[model samples]
Target chain A: MHEHIQPVALEKAYRLLNHGPTVLVSSHHDGVDNVMAAAWACALDFAPPKLTVVLDKATKTRELIEKSGRFVIQVPTVKLLRLTHEVGTRSLANEPSKLQDTGVELLHLAGDTLPFVAGCSGWLECRLVPEPHNQATYDLFIGEVVAAWADDRVFYDGHWHFETAGREWGSIHHIAGGHFYAIGEQMSARPKRGG
Target chain B: MHEHIQPVALEKAYRLLNHGPTVLVSSHHDGVDNVMAAAWACALDFAPPKLTVVLDKATKTRELIEKSGRFVIQVPTVKLLRLTHEVGTRSLANEPSKLQDTGVELLHLAGDTLPFVAGCSGWLECRLVPEPHNQATYDLFIGEVVAAWADDRVFYDGHWHFETAGREWGSIHHIAGGHFYAIGEQMSARPKRGG
Candidate 1:
């Protein structure tokens, strides 16, 4: 685990995905692990924090997730854009060890065997919620977050503090092809009275 | 409809919500109309574009969506953040004429009677895909994008061209409380070679 990583409160886990950054889904099953990039993921609930992510029917990650019923969502930083795009474009079924091909390292959390992509700003370890209809129909999987962690350099105290983390720490929001936008320019709005 | 608004290809419609900006869901039923803010929404499919959004069962927007089976998703710019946050905090059930109270104008698309929030960057007119079990169990709603439009000034040729739209035109990404981050800083990555 990275030295800056720390446990995120379960209640506040949704914050990790609230901004809608492109995430890398990591799954391990039967001694085989695979990672794939996904932009179609978001927070689905607040308190017993839950999230939904799309894993296309043909992807190896989807197969691994189904068999193991576990996956990790890793929010890649701007610095990892190349690796993110690489993993997104190539399939593990085609490359067989795609993570190794991209030169992206996988790190295991303390006392946990599941693999998480290195150099990510946040990690959400999720257990599949078993909505078979949704999975079969829409390629969507809903998961209840069992544990969450974040790199304190960019996230802490239930908020993303990227302003001080330097440009490389900003999260990536993919557009299409290899294009992406780095999460930027924080602002706040005041609610009107009685609103 | 704004003169600058033009049709967006259904195949590229997912780009509207791909980055995960906060959305204003407007619906009309039995001569009554309502709009609500949703932060939990994302693209679910590509070809026949589909998206999912969470509307708590208690929300009037949910009731309107259920009754009408139709709704419009408006991607609000940073300038509309206050109004977005306002509608999100107040329920139309309590205020009755909440849209009028917020001072946000509603404009009708030429051939459609449905109401769409003006001053937004993109609009997606959708018809609900009934998933009773999902709706009841998770407050989740799925909609297939039937028609879509975008402000040519901000989006054209199937991509969000926010760079030239000025700061106020950037889409807003909501965080907890009233804070938001304006979508910012475009970048691209190079795809690595195959394994």
Candidate 2:
């Protein structure tokens, strides 16, 4: 694991994905690991944090996740935009060594062998919450976050510290095709009245 | 509806929510209408577009949606940040007239009494796909896009045209505690290999 990576409290795990950036979903099973881009992931619950991500039925990542019952979601920074786009467009089944081709280093965490993308801003280790009907009907998988981590430079204390972390560390949001938008200026607003 | 609002192709409706912006979910039932801010929303499928959004069981918006079996998701721009934050914090159940207090105008569509939030970048009219288990267990609602529309200034021809659209028109992404990041600069990349 990266030295800068710090553990995030399970209750605050949703903060990692709350801003809605595109993420890389990594899964390992039977000595095979695969990573793919998923823009359709979002936090579903707060405590005992749960998330939902759409995985195409044909993707290798989906197969690995189904078999292993676990997966990791990594929030790729702007610096990894090109690599994210590259991995998103190619499949591990067709290019068996696509991860190597993309030059993305995988880091083995202290306790788990499941590898996480090294340079990401945050990581969410998850255990699949089986929903066969949803999976077969909509290709949606729900995962309960088992553990979470974030690089302290950009995210710490359950809040994104991106204002001073620099633009290169900001997360990427895919628009369409190969186009993406770097998360921009942060602003604060006050409610007009109390509920 | 606003004169500038134009119909979006049903097949490409997913693009509106693909980038993952905080949206205003509006539903009407029993002569009462309500809108609330939901950040936990994302595209669940591509064709015959589907979306999933989290609405806490306590919310009146959830009740209205369950009774009416329909809702409209409006993508608020930077201009609506304050209103978005205000609506999110205030609930119709408490205020009863919260919408009027927020100063957000509602526009009536040609053939439906369901109101759409004016001044938003895109609008998705949806019919709920009843998933009893998911809804009861996770407070999650799934809806299929029945009609879609977008502001020509920010979206056109099935793609987000935010590059030419001014900053005020860019979508708003909620971080936490009233903080938001306006959708920013667009960048494109090429995949290293084909799928």
Query: In candidate 2, what are the lDDT values of residues A1-195, reduced to their tens digit?
Result: 467899999998988888899999998998897889999999999888999999998799999999999999989998899999988999998999999998878887637778799889999999999999999999999999999999999999788877889988989999788889888888777644774
Give the docking tier of candidate 2: high
In terms of lDDT, model 2 sits at 0.90
Off by over 4 Å in 1: A191-195, B191-195
Candidate 1 on B93-140: residue-level lDDT in tens? 889888889987988873666889999999999999999998998888
Clashing residue pairs, candidate 2? none
i-RMS for every candidate: 0.8, 0.8
Model 2 chain A: lowest-lDDT 10 consecutive positions: A186-195
Q: Write one digit per residue (lDDT tens) for candidate 1, span A111-132.
A: 5667899999999999999999
